[model samples]
Each structure stands twice: as C-alpha cells, then as structure tokens.
Target: GGVALVIDGKALGHVLEQGMHHAIVRLGSVCSSVVCCRSTPVQKQQVVKTMKEALPIRTLAIGDGANDVAMIQEAHVGFGVMGNEGMQAVMSSDFVIGQFRFLKRALLLHGRWNYLRTGL
Candidate 1:
C-alpha cells in the first residue's frame, strides 16, 4: 500500500540507468545493472537467468502481480505483496507481505534474526 510512482517505461529506464551509473562510480564497480522494458513473463525469466549466469550469487525477485509469477518462481527468494490486488502473486510467493514496509524490515533485520535462530 505504500508503493508510489508509476512512470512511463522510457523515463523509468533512463532513471534506472542513471542510478546504476552513479552506483558504479560511487562504489568503484558495478553493484547492479538495469534492464529496461521487459514486457513479458518469459522475458523476465530470461533476464533473471541471464543475471544468475553472469553472477555467482543468489538472486531475489519481489513483485505484486500475475505478470511477475514466473520471475518470482525463478529466484532464490521470492516475495509477494498481499492484502492488495495481488492474489495470484501472493499464492505463488515464498513470503507474502500483508504490510508492505514490513517487507524491508523482514529482509533486513527479522529475516536475519530468523536465520540465526534457526542456524541456517
């Protein structure tokens, strides 16, 4: 529910590229890359697979709609926003967020605590 900003693809892509460039300059390496305007489920899966092939680490996918189900399923960690208009996505997700901001805390703090508690 706290989500905001719906920008056109061209503008969103430009902003994402700029952010990636800034991160590269500030971090002295590329921390992430931006792929713009992937308009299909299969395309999204391919993007995820490509990134995984490029990097030797796990990937996470988070989304809130039916269009994102495939990508979510492809990732090591998948989260879906619930209590919104996202029934299908929630059903397919590894974790469902009833409260959106709780997701950040869950991944950043609580999730770590849980891992430590479980010794996993």
Candidate 2:
C-alpha cells in the first residue's frame, strides 16, 4: 500500500535537496502521489524538472493559470486548460483544451493513436 503526501512549499525545498534518484526512490516507496500545496512557481517547475530528469517515463503537467506557466513549460508534455484563469498557460503549453474533462480524450485517444503512429 502507498500513501498520499501533502507537502507545502517549505517542505519541497528540503525534498529537492536530496539526490534525484534517492528522492524518487524514497518517495515512491511510501507515496503514490505527492501534492505540493502553496508552492511557488519555481517550486512547481522544480518538481516537473526533477521528475523529467530522474525518471525515464514521460512527465505531463496540467494547469490553467499564469502561476502554472513555469511548471507547464518545464514538463515533457504540458496540458493547458482554457478557463477564466487566463491564457498564459495556454500559450506555453504543448496542448490546449477547452475544458478539463477533454483531457481524457486527449490523453487516452489522441495520445495513444499518435504514439502508435509514431512508434515512440
């Protein structure tokens, strides 16, 4: 069984100071998901960048506001939600969607088809 961790901005700094592999392994061993709350833009970006650098798997960041722009841009695949938040995220993202629910179709259908076609 795994846990869900809720880490605030200050805690994120300490987590990142450890080596990437150690951090990933330690986190994976205990938690299935880690939600960072009240994190700064740089902290958000660091999380994405750390995952991208430490793991072989693709990393996707989803956001809808200007505050998320850095994190979205740092991810391998950035998904932007078009909403009242603003357009900065949309401008920086690799893919843009009208609503958050459409993310299901984008990732499961179109994403899978593209993966099959490209053989990536």
Candidate 3:
C-alpha cells in the first residue's frame, strides 16, 4: 500500500481530504482506508485508536518534533529523528536517529541484527 503524508494543522485538513479522495480513486479497491488532516494530539490518538479497532496490527511512528510526541507514544514503535541538536523528539522516542541516512540502518540492520541475536 502507498503512504499518506499530512501536515499538522486544521488548514491541512482540506489538503488531506483531497488527497484521500485522490488516493481512493487512484488505488481503488486496494485502498483500505483514508485519513484526513489531524490538528491535535488528541486527534492523532483517536486516529490510531480507530485504525486499531478496524484492524488490529502493530504500528510504528517516526517523527522529529515536539508536536509528534503524542502520536509517537501511541505507536508500538516510535523513532525520533535528530537532524539537529536540541530536538525534543529525541528525548521522547524509544530510538533516536542522529542522521537521516542512519535511520535505514538503525531500523533494518541494527534492529534486526539485535533481534536475531536475542531472539526477541
């Protein structure tokens, strides 16, 4: 499935709504869901809850700002992107990435390697 990108704000709602419609038409029956603009942490949590109710599955949240802390906490795995110093997201996440390129290695290579070693 394709991913949906949303900006955090009420104004982005219209954009997300349009994107959702376009995604529905473009992906047709393969599109399982559509989520519109979310303006608050409460809304983000509600969305996650709704998705879980619809289909119980693990979810991962990756973010790089203080605004993302709530959603990150709601996800099964939360990754904080530390592109620069003093980013609050790094403090709140389960894992922190110092560089953008290292994110792939952290998730795929390091995480998997550790999992294999521990069998957890």
Candidate 4:
C-alpha cells in the first residue's frame, strides 16, 4: 500500500527534463503511490517518459481527453477511457476500454501471459 502524490507543477522548472525525471524516479521508489492531479498535458507525458527512462517500467497510461493523447502515446500500454472526454485519447491509444474496472483483470492476465512467454 502506498500514497499517491499530486506533484505540484510549481515545483517543476520551466525546463522539466531534469526535474521531471527526478520526480518520477522518486515516485517509482515508493510502492503504489501514483502521480496525479497534474494540470498540464505535458506533465502527464513527462512522468511517463521519465519513468520509462529511469526504470524497467512497462507503463500503462489511461486517459479520456485530447489532453491525454501525448501521455497515452508516451506509455508502453495506452488504455483509453472511451466516451469520457473525447475520442482523441482512444484514437491514440493501444486499446480502448469502456470501464476502469476491467484494468485489473487486463493487467493480471497480460502480466501472466507475458511472464510465461518471456520468462521475465
């Protein structure tokens, strides 16, 4: 169990490369804390790119708006929340899902299958 941290955008510098990577790395060191409440679309993508670079993370970005498109594309697995905000997120996503509830089984089954296939 972990807490989610809504990283304050004010804490980030105008040049977010270094700052964003540090933030995501710190967040990843903890167990279940998610980055949230971000106000910028760029921030969403920044977190994913940072984590992907600093860790062996296979990220799943879920979104429902045009703002989420870049973030979804930045992730290893992009799940779109269909009909929530717009179709843009879904159009750019790897998969479109109707409900958030299904993510658990999707991840579980996908993880299991990948493990068997790759032995990772």
Candidate 5:
C-alpha cells in the first residue's frame, strides 16, 4: 500500500525550517511519494537539503527551468530537462535529458546500472 502526499510551499515552510525527522517519520509511514507544489527556489533547495540530511537515501531532483538550478545542485543526483527554460539547470545538473519522457529509461535502466556498478 502507498500514498502520495501533495504539499504546497506554504504548508511545508515550517517543516523546512526545523524538526524534519518528525515530519519525515509521520509522512513516510503513510506515503511512498511526495509532491511539493508552488515552492520557491529557496524552498526547493531547503527541501532537498532537509531530506538529504534526514534520510539515509540518495536524493534525486529534476527540473527544466532556471528557478530549479539551486535544487538541482543541492540533490545527490540531478536531472535537467532541456527545454526553452534555458541552460542554467542543465549546467547545474549531474545529467541532462532532451525530454522528460526519457526520465523513466534514464532512471530505471542507466540509473540502476550505475547504482549496481557503484555499489551505492
């Protein structure tokens, strides 16, 4: 069983500031994924930082805009989608993809192969 929690920027602001473990535990028990919407660049970075520090798992951030540069850089692995947004995100990302649909193959295939090879 799994759930996806949709949190807006404002609702997550407080959690981003402090006590992320509590929020992670409470949320993790019920949800397998989280979708944060209407977040600022700072908020996006903080979320990535908070999760990276709080969990023992690698973090991945994906974006296609300049506003996503900070978040992309902050994550353990960042994927930038090439689009009209510009090259800021592409430069900051660990990897760049021409289209969003390719994310599945990139992650499920190449990403998995890399993970196994690296033993991470």
Candidate 6:
C-alpha cells in the first residue's frame, strides 16, 4: 500500500517544478503513501514547502545541523536532532528530544496537545 518514488535531486526538482502536482496525483492513485528523497536539506525543504502549498497535509522535518534549518522552518512542525548537534536545531525546533525513540511521543502526543492548545 505504498509508492516509493525514490528520486534524486534532479528528478525531485522536476516533480517540484509543478508545485508537487505530480506527487499529489501519484499519491491519489496509491494505496496510501509516497516516500520522496532529495539530495540536500535545502532541496528537501523546498519540496516540503511546495507540497504544503499544494496539499492540506502537515509535514514534519527533522535534521541535526544548521544545514537542516531551512527544512525545519519549512515544515508545519520541526524536530531538531539534539545532543548530537549543539543547541542550534533544538533551539529552532517546536519541540526538542534527545533520542529518535522519543519522537513518537513528541510527534504523536505533544503535537496534538500543542494543536489543541493553540486552538488551531
């Protein structure tokens, strides 16, 4: 029930040129998922921004360094890799966690709680 469109930078740019029109259409015909990969964090952020503009879904961008800043800011929610990197990503993130395992609670439980708290 998924489509793994593992594209690189060039192909990602092509797909995004249309404001993720292609990905959206492909997603519509899928069983329920699509995993798109890009080369750099900046490119990743661009893709997420385009997808957000074209769709109503929320995006979660994660990274460990300054390189990840753009994507982190681009997402509806961002998770910075803490401990491994300094305070950079953690400071920029909506919520901070030290381990990947903690992301489940941060993303699932805290995300909903924040949304409700914000009245969004």
- In candidate 3, position 26 carries an lDDT of 46
Candidate 5 lDDT over 6-76, as tens digits, reads: 88888777776675646854674466666678888998887777777767877788999999999999999
Model 2 lDDT tens row, 3-112: 87677887777766654546744674466655667888888888877666766656788888999999998888999999999899999999999999999999999999
Stretches of candidate 4 off by over 4 Å are 8-20, 110-120
> Clash pairs of candidate 4?
none
Provide the clash count, candidate 2: 0
Top candidate on lDDT is 5
Every model's Cα RMSD, please? 6.8, 3.1, 5.6, 3.1, 2.6, 3.8
Provide the global lDDT of candidate 3 against the true structure.
0.63
Candidates sorted by lDDT, best first = 5, 2, 4, 6, 1, 3
1-120, model 3: which lDDT tens digit per residue? 665544455744553455453432343223343343446665565455445444556666666777777877877788889865457778888998877678789979998999999995
Judge candidate 5 against the unseen true structure and give its global Cα lDDT, from 0 to 1.
0.83
Predicted structure 3, TM vs. truth: 0.61
Model 6 TM-score (2 dp): 0.68
lDDT of 1 by residue, 1-120 (tens): 232223335554454456543422233224443332544666556555555665666777777789888988988888888765658888898998886777889798988898899995
Q: How accurate is candidate 2 locally (lDDT)?
A: 0.81
Scored against the true structure, residue 21 in model 2 reaches a CA lDDT of 42
- Decoy 2 TM-score against native: 0.78
Error of 3 at 95 (Å): 0.3
User: Could you tell me how far off, in angstroms, the CA of residue 43 lies in candidate 3 after the best superposition?
Assistant: 3.5
Better of 1 and 3 by lDDT: 1
- State how far residue 101 of model 5 sits from its true place (Å): 1.0
Model 3 lDDT-worst window of ten: 21-30
